[model samples]
Target: MDIATKQPGVLKPKVGSRSQNIMASRVVLTVLMFALGILMILPFLWMISASLKLQIDVFEFPIRWIPENPQWQNYERVWAGRYPFYRFYVNSIIVTVGATSLVLLTASLGGYAFGKLDFPFKETLFLSYLAMMMIPPQVLLIPRFIMFNWMGWLDTLTVLIIPNAVSAFGTFLLRGFYEQIPKDLSEAAIIDGAGHVRIWSRIIMPLTRPAMLALMIISAMWRWNDYLQPLVFLRRVTNYTIPLGLDFFVQENTAQMNLIMAAAVTATIPLLLLFLITQKYFIRGIVLTGIKG
Candidate 1:
């Protein structure tokens, strides 16, 4: 009986020790993650600090997190200067919004057809479509430029918007989500006299909000940041998007780091706002996108 009582006492210490080990490990992990988060945000913090500082203070030995005398005029020079930076904002917004909308519409329709509909040579067509993605975008740049020139679209925002409107990746993303949706839902809709258009818009589209948001975010980011295509196509300074506009600012104000940083901060606000608003749905969409039927 004394031995049996000793066995229970020994087991209690082992269990307590295991719990303590787990708690210690968790505390260590939490500290590491917190450090990493701070590290990742440091660049943005530096940018903001530099934006508010004079050019001489930007590369100071011991970085100041905040400037003693904030130069709010850096932002004023960027916005009110002769460069027409506000026009760049308008052009970027137009192209990004237009491309993102088109991507969503086309990707949803194509995904619905591929994932839900019965048709001849469907797999072969999809494979062919996927094959297009393998071809280097640079290889087609010359041809696209020639085609745009022929169509009188060069130096226009249309050149920027049209190429990005259809996205192979977006279709692939939404198709996976669409496939996981039960066929019974579409069948029931059909029985209720709903056609393909109605089914796609009313029945199927509502269930795939997460995937749609993911695609929208992806397409918008791509269009917003595109430089190469705009550089190759756009000639007029008036037609420049944010990336091109920033490039122009950098060229003209090479010594004015403060002004450059201020311009960058202004350019980044829209994307930051977009993420802050839709991050919840974006995360949900990304998680649900991978689960297969």
Candidate 2:
């Protein structure tokens, strides 16, 4: 009887040890994540630092984390240069918006049709379209250039906007999201005399906002940083997008390291702002895609 009465508290030390182990593991994970975050952001810090330093100080021994003499004028010079940076910004904005809009419209419709609507050989057609994603864009570059040339679209904004109007990846992404929606909802809408157009517009589209937002962000980033297409298509200085304009700036001012960094920093601001604003939607889209798929 005495032994049994004394044994009630024996397990408490074991429970305390287990809790301590969990807390220790959490602390280790937190430290690792913090270190990784710092590592990832180091390049951005260096870029900003380089943008403020003089040309000669850029690669100085024992790399400078902070510039001794900050050159705020580097930004001014970049903006006020002979090559029009403002025009490049406007061109990027226009192309990014137009292409992103077209992608959203086409991808959503295509996804809806493939995921929900019945059609002849629908699976085959979607599979074929998905296969196109496997083909390298480089292989089609010459053919696309010739076709655009034939259409008299070279050296124009249309060249940038039209070719990227639709994306197979976008269609596939949205289709996966759409397929996760319950069939009962769509059937109920159909019984209520709603057409495919009405059902998609009213029910499907609103529910998949996260996927659409993700696509928008992705398309915008691709169009904004598009160096190769703009380089090949655009001929005139005034028609140059941000990437091409930056290349031209660098070519003209090879020794002006600070100026180049300043231009790069300016070019990066829009994408950073866009990501910061929509990161929630982007993360949600990715998570949902994984879960649904």
Candidate 3:
């Protein structure tokens, strides 16, 4: 006779109780996650609501989830204001795109060499790069500023693009992804008369796409939202990026909270869109990197 059939009463109660416990635990976890998700989204909802309100209504006594009268014109004012916000948009796009592209190129090649190819002092070099990450970015500001000033790059878009073109973090993240790839694939490519370039391009790169996508999103976000670097490097008002331009606007129009919110919303939309578009790859990249590393 089967065990269940031989001990029906005992097995049934034990199995039922275990299942009930599991179901209860899952229910509690689900409720907690749902509440946390809502909490995280609340600030974004408030920002959207405030962007449509009148200046005087923004910080009114009690919180207003929705404005009584929406001021849609705030967006137009932000774009057409004396600050030339369009210029900031163009500058930001140029810098963000240029820096992100350069970072990907350098990081991929460096990661491949460090992770796959053999070379002298490779580990030592990579360890040094990792050590650099521990140094606070603030500590590098003076040296970078002086170097850029010497190169006559200050106040130019090149200043923004060149200084941050390569990232240690990008290299480290991509290296982890590359190391996770099986070496046998590279060996097979080599046997087929493929050089390192061909093996990297044809075999390794295609496999590590999720990691690259994550790096792209991360690099783009940092470049786009950078404030201090732009504030220090860019002098001309017309050359300002979105963050610096928004700060200027807030300073000039301190009383116009509605306009400020509109500007903030405009600055945030691109990042939101980027995350939405690559969210799947981004999450996969994070999980894979964490596990592999």
Q: For each candidate, give its TM-score against the true structure.
A: 0.88, 0.86, 0.84
lDDT values, one for every candidate: 0.86, 0.86, 0.85
| Model 1, span 186-270: residue lDDT tens | 9998999999999899978999886788777667777999989999999998899999999988898999899999988877766
What's the distance in Å from true for residue 241, model 1? 1.4
- List the candidate 1 regions with Cα displacement exceeding 4 Å: 1-14, 286-293
Candidate 2 regions exceeding 4 Å error are 1-18, 21-25, 286-293
When sorted by TM-score, best at the front, the candidate numbers are: 1, 2, 3
Per candidate, the number of residue pairs that clash is 0, 0, 0
**Tens digits of per-residue lDDT for model 3 on 147-177?**
9999899999999898799898889988888
Give the per-residue lDDT digits (tens) of candidate 2, residues 1-293. 23332244355547766556566667777798999999998888888899999888998879878899899989888888787688899998899999999999999999999889889999799889989989998888889899999999999999999889989988998998899999999999999999999999999999998888878767777898889899888899999999999899889889888888888887886678777897887666566555643
Best candidate (score: TM-score): 1
Could you tell me the TM-score of candidate 3?
0.84
Alpha carbon deviation, residue 196, candidate 1 (Å): 1.2
- Candidates 2 and 3 compared: the better one by TM-score is 2
